[model samples]
Target: MRNPSLAPPINRGLILRDFPKAEDTPTVQDTNENDTNWVALMVRVRDQRDKTAFAALFTHFAPRIKGFLINSGADAPLAEECAQDVMTTLWHKAAQFDPARASVATWIFTIARNRRIDMLRRQRRPEPDDLTWGPAPEPDQADVLALQQETASLSVAMAALPAPQRDLIEKAYFKDLSQSEIAKITGLPLGTIKSRLRLALDRLRHAMK
Candidate 1:
């Protein structure tokens, strides 16, 4: 049977208080010694289910995770909930941690980032009952014509763009890719992605006007 003590702490307030303020949180860029220690702690949690190691990790990372979520636009309550979820996931998925690919802080922060994204997506999703099942309304002819004209103008503007800028814009809006994802796919630096997308958007805006 699983030991009850191995379960994550339920007292969140106490956990939050254990760490220093978010601004003081150590990042992935911290000293190599600290990073190496975190890796060892994670390995202990994975191989032995060591509660002491888990507690130490929790004490160090919980506040940092919470702060990261808040900075990513999650409110306090949501950030706290997501931080707890990230820690719980860490306990369960310790075996999945690949030290060769990423440091402990990077893995933990990635989980927190994904958790916040999932929560935001759930909040923005429309309830099934709120969806319109049948839509039979006919479009107004004038509105349809206006839309067609606007679409044609947009197409022309898009075609006029330099290939690189247009490609980035298409990936960003049409493919719904994050800047980081776009950078990886295009083999471009992240700053280049942002710069091209910004320039592309500015031209498109001016063209549409």
Candidate 2:
């Protein structure tokens, strides 16, 4: 039940059943926990120029953020650079920290993810816009979870639909074809394709709700 963020070796130990760092990690914070509040530390750093507290938090969180990147397949140097960028952001945006919205670690990781992705995109620098369709940016954690939820919802919705409707919806979205395209491919009338797609989407919407 511990926060996975605190255990840098969890990814390394995924093949095993146990992780030692996890032993010292807490499962959850108390509602009123006040000691070493990261949000408050940022506020003090911003308003009172409290470098001491800021340094402590930065030192603790930076390596953890770097681990997240390295474990996700980035090289050590890139991860460290991204980690530094994340901390620089913390310094500049200290006044913007909101404890209620996310934990300090989550905020740090989100910054790291964005900065790392930006670095990667710049490094790859996809072909000129005219030469290629732009590559999609990798989704952050929130987007990934939202996509997974959408997949799950779609699965359930598809299951709830009568088989024929699910098939139509699949052909429409997953196959990325127009109704007329699907009609031509499936040898059905365009009107029938449109009707099936509409009815299928309606059922999916209701089922998802």
In candidate 1, stretches whose alpha carbon ends up further than 4 angstroms from where it belongs are 1-30, 123-209
The 0-to-1 C-alpha lDDT of every candidate, in the order given, reads: 0.59, 0.52
Number of the predicted model whose TM-score against the real structure is largest: 1
lDDT per residue for candidate 2 within 1-209, as digits (tens), equals: 88866866422211111221222334212211322266567657766778897898887788888887775567999888888888989888765554333346556766676676577665533322321211122213343333223323333333444455446645553345686655533432223224433543354346446
The estimated TM-scores of all candidates read: 0.47, 0.43
> How does model 1 score by TM-score?
0.47
Q: Which stretches of candidate 2 lie over 4 Å from their true place?
A: 1-36, 123-209
Q: What local lDDT does model 2 show for residue 137?
A: 24
